[model samples]
Target chain A: MNLGILIAGLLTLAIYSFLYKDNPVYRAAESLLIGLSIGYTLVLFWQSTLFDKLFYPLLREHGIWLTIPLILGLMMFSRLTRKWSWLSRIPIALMIGAGAGAAIPAMLYARTLKQVSATVHPLIMENGGFDISAVVVVIGVLTTLAYFYFTREHKGVMGKMARVGTYFLMIFFGATFGYTVMSRLSTLIGRIDFLLGDFLHLLK
Target chain B: MNSNKTRWIIYSTLLIVVVLSYLLGINLITHPSPEVQKSYTFIENLPESSVVMVSFDHEASSLPEIQPISLILLRHLFRRNLRVVGLSLFAEGTAIGYRTLTKVAQEYGKQYGHDYVFLGFKPQHISAILGMGESIRGVFPEDYFGNKIEEIPLMRKIRNYDDILVVISIADGDRTMQWIEYAGAKYHQRIMAGLTAAMITTYDPYLASGQLSSAVGGLKGAAEYENLYGRRGMGNRGMVAQTAAHIFIIVLIVIGNILYFKNRSKGGGNR
Candidate 1:
């Protein structure tokens, strides 16, 4: 008899009760889930980041290099006061600047350059066979780009290309929508299995 | 019937069908996708004792889909005698990654520090990813259990991405994309992903570009890997109920379209 399984099963029922109609029990469970998640995250960050990274190095190891980050971190608390609220922006600016600096080039390379390289494949395979899928992808890419082109009025050939682009977009959205349904159903199936197999012992 | 009552009927019927399907134990036969096979094959052919980094790049909500995928990946890595450096970009994944790693390791009689080490969660994920391209121990100075990174035998050997063979991200969201951008693109480290079904399409561009070496996606991905691994697990167990629910939803959709057209024809404005 696992107390954990029992408690989890009841909470699961509480959550699913909303489908029947919302009630006090469902709200309580929802609140509990959110509160516990935040509490758990706070404890985790306190231990992993604040204590381990900041206080430990500052106090025990006598590491002086970490002081810069420590001060920046402490300065963030200025946001609590009306007068010093502007002071908090210094740290935020630094964080944003650093993050963007490190991320932008990498993002551009991966999201754009590599994608373009992949798109520019020869219409013929190395084996000298025609690449039908390559042709479809090329058309898909051109048409999709045409849909997003705002400078040109969508008339004549542009209109047709944009219309084709819409079909590709719909195909993507449909595939994504189907997968989303499957993913949600997977979660549902998991909870049902837990309730029946673990808590009720109804399944072997 | 009132709309509310009809809604209730649909819900009740779906639930009853799922329960019945569960009792009847109707499972769909699952096969590994080409992407899953590619990931498996890549991991299988790695030289013995190569180091691999696996990031539990998901929150706790998606654990049902993710757990089986993570379990199977770790199982295969352990079997291949690869040293795994486990960590999580998501805070919830710290305990989750450690728990999964320990479970799989125990099954293979593997030691914690010798066979694997969980480097724990790192805040500021992109920074952590880039920093790990330089130094893993620098990024995560301590393990999940608060042991110094220097103390772990596995951590001592794996200084950065260069020392690691590949990075596997078990993700339910865009963290895998960040990995592809920062870790794989910037450092040229190989990447594979285990994703929720919904995220499969999101990563298609990356997969097509070979930015992701391969991806195993969702509960079906789990079932497929289980089949490949020659062991049935939760992924298989959930399939019957999923199939039952899917059929019910389809039936509802069909009935909905019928009622919609009929109402429109009668000038009831799609009642």
Candidate 2:
């Protein structure tokens, strides 16, 4: 346990050192992480999809039909040989085509139609209540959307509105940036805390 | 000339104080435990034994956020005796989500087919979702563990979105919105979303529109869930770290503004 803790603490410090200066230690840790992830993903893809969906079905009942994907999959590895790499395009094309076919209609309905339609309504209080939040949201959405209008020129009232929209866009963008940074920093902190708290037992 | 050094010392001292305050206990106290209250209200309202579609639509990178929610919600559902069918829009979440689901389900003595089933991920995400809406079995011919759909008793009963009483989409991107627009809007699956805090406001419209029944936003949302389940998990820890980090950033920003004003007052060389 002592040895485990020491090594973890060292690795955490090593990775964190990248923030101060770029060096071989950080590079080695980063590369190892990438390699391990790739190795793990291959094993999972085989166990979850290839073995369960393809292999098991072939051996039991589906037989020849399953062989088609298996052979096409094997053909994919032929790209390792420079001369035969072109042949791999056949399977890749089919995969891309199927992916595109799936994405297009779904993107149209889910993203284009639904999202735009969702933006059209502003909440209004029925009787006594006032929807202040909804009003602010409507103003924000319209302004932000207008800020993205590059095809037209801004002047007078239009220019002022566009400028106000730009401010809202910046705040939104800044908040998003802040959140993303926090999320990433939390991951880094987790690793560091493990090194400090659990691995090093320093904090404890 | 001496004041410059004194100013530096004062700034660094302030930095250290803020950091210490944030790290030690200040943050935990400030960030209220509203998460528990919100999640409790959500679960309390949901009907017992209702079929719910659990979209574990997150990558391995987001396991920190997605995993706890998966475990806690799984326990909550199983304990409530609700039927769950799991699917992932993201490739990386499939395996991680499966392990989490199985681990929690086993702890609760929940049987796989009788209580929950994991319909593994498909690369054709939009097509897969549309297919599942049309036919659940057609989209996932077998469960993640390679069990046939027919053999899984839970899968046998679940046919489409309409059968699902609630749709819980835990995601890092607009994918949750996709589920809301497609399944929730089209099929009227009572929807709830759990998303990264940063991305939550983007979906506020959906929440206000009544498209989403409720939402658990980011680590706060997860923490709320852990509170409701009466279990301390990653979210609570994350909130601690997040609170620390936010305070750090806020302090940095203040220092920056001070430096700007100070330089302006002195008429510094650099513009």
Per-prediction TM-score: 0.97, 0.78
Error of 2 at B142 (Å): 2.9
The native-contact fractions of the candidates, in order shown, are 0.73, 0.15
i-RMSD per candidate, Å? 1.0, 4.4
Q: Which stretches of candidate 1 lie over 4 Å from their true place?
A: none
List where candidate 2 sits over 4 angstroms from the true fold.
A1-14, A47-102, A122-124, A192-204, B1-40, B185-190, B210-213, B264-271
* Model 2 chain B weakest lDDT span, ten residues long: B26-35
Which of the CAPRI classes, incorrect, acceptable, medium or high, describes model 2? acceptable
Candidate 2 per-residue lDDT, tens place, B115-213, comes to: 888887776466666677888888788787668898987777778876888778888887787776667655666777767666766776666556667
DockQ of each: 0.79, 0.25
> Chain A TM-score for model 1, please?
0.96
> All candidates' lDDT scores?
0.89, 0.71
